[model samples]
Target chain A: MLCSDSDLPAPPQEALDALCLRGARLLSGPVWAAAEVALAAPVVEAVALQGGRIEVFLRTPAAPDEALCGVLEDSADLEAALNVLWSGIDAILPEDTARTADATRRGP
Target chain B: MGDLDRLNSKLAKLKGKDDGQIRASATDSIVSALLTEIEETILPREMILTNESGNRFVLVVAGRRLLALSGHGAEEEGSEGREDAAARIIAVFRGPFRTFLDNAREISIDAARPPNRIDPTMIGCSVETLTAALVGPGQASVADPVAAACDLAVAGLRLVGGDVVGRSGDAAHLARLEQFAGVGGAGLGQLAGDDTDAPCCVFLSDAGREDAILARIAFRGAAALILAPPEARAELIALCREPIPAAG
Candidate 1:
């Protein structure tokens, strides 16, 4: 039940559920099952006991010397974990920023 | 040199480095690309979680380990539990080729004894795979990637210089990479033999230099493995919120 971007009608709960389930059934059964077990609301809340919210200040995008605390006061736990998982990518930024910046000075 | 000349040099240099009925095969540029990948993918740069549709998702992570994620998405628009985002996220973490090249994500594990929500099997499998693929007899951490690069550089050096250390080298640099893994005494015969169908020269090039720099690896005629500058590793891990206890 795929819909074109321009004419996307409000999909029903069951159809949306089916669409989501179909998106991930191919990876592995156990992985889906395990995640389904943990992704339950109660299970997701249990993460708070294990270290709910990690403090990720803004050092990479702005001044590292004076890092700013992030604002995630109202977001859910699973979303937080997913956010941090992507954050590790910052570890591998190229060391040649100055050189590239110099090269970019001549760009149109 | 011209691109064609460089291409021929690359082709001449690459004999059995790419294709064969062998256990493994890799080239210096491919290795360079790996380093570039490690550099671009391993660390955190921002605390914001931007999704694929250019929207933002919000959350904070603490140790049991806390880091930031960028460009993560939920399959159907919704919250955590009801949504299968966790399943999708796990699949991405445990997915193929460093979690799919376009959407690479990190996997969580407990090298030391604290636990997190991720399935134990996922960590175990990734550890075993990373160990068998690159790490030798040690836990996977910063050292695993550093060792992989040095191993490639070392093997490349042996091919072009006819010796592991070549003619000139920095003893400190060689010792440092050697400490990361058991990548010592990798001989030329291990990669290619004159009597075999795979006969060619392969070189291990350092990141910014036209020739090898650290350990002065392969200065005689070709480049071999050597430690990248300590600063590169330092800068890479600088962004992680919690210190990864030194990899053994």
Candidate 2:
């Protein structure tokens, strides 16, 4: 979508990365897959796949605003979203990541 | 005459009941309605998800003040076809987000995304899962099924390494969603902004193993789901109280 809106400046990839470092969250999928639901990625202006990382350019919520999914102000909103989405869907990350998650699961 | 009529009739029968009886009935009626509305909005049927123990339950979202309710459904593996997938995808990514995806396709980033390719059965609980999880076992009250669900969700987060960190951090431009707390300032749904609709975005990020774990944890929260059996806390506690697994 950012490509079409070329007139408008794309938000820097660094901004979203900063949020990620600060633990800001973003969802990476196209909005259409509910059955394969992941958490909501905030204002996704652009997306790129450099090597392994899918560099998503997101518009940081500048003010108290309404999102289609979670509350805007909630920082942990992304984390919460991921929790719900991944309850069933699996291994969106590399297989190794999934193994790590499985490792953490306290088995009976 | 119908469902509401039947519900009303049931309520009428309880009119002369004792205070305790009336409160319990009222709580059940109101809470069930909240859960049912969300369920119908998401799932095509009253299908309930169960675990190895045969414990039957579902998840739903409870908003802050009020969050938007999405009626669309997400897609899964056994699809009818590409057309079916396209239709479902369109349904999920409505409004401004649709624009976001539309532009995204031009560069074909979706094709390049491998780490994001998901087995829906593993993540995205469908709409049936998310809001339902938020509706939780604790939405009704402090001692209701909604509270218990919330506790389970909290445990689920903890299981995935999502801990309650302090609100204040360094002088950074943004703080993680963990910093904010939800109702009663308890750190629930902190990022659940007073938004319009729910059942939002699908997750696809390529972070480290730890970030992946965190993402999965966030996906759990977004899905708002857990596999805890819904039981009465009071009676269960009196019966030696095998704790609700890892709840807060």
lDDT of 2 by residue, B154-177 (tens): 122221223343222122211222
Q: Score chain A of each prediction against the true chain A by TM-score and list the results.
A: 0.21, 0.29
Instruction: Output the lDDT of residue B115, model 1.
Output: 36
Candidate 1 residue-wise lDDT, B158-178, digit = tens: 324333443223554444434
What candidate 1 keeps of the native contacts, as a fraction, is 0.00
- For candidate 2, give the DockQ: 0.01
lDDT of 1 by residue, A15-90 (tens): 5554334222311233223322222211111011002122222223221122222212111232334345335423
TM-score of 2: 0.17
lDDT of each: 0.28, 0.27
Leading candidate by TM-score: 1
Q: Runs in model 1 with CA error above 4 Å?
A: A1-108, B1-54, B58-72, B76-88, B92-141, B155-208, B216-248
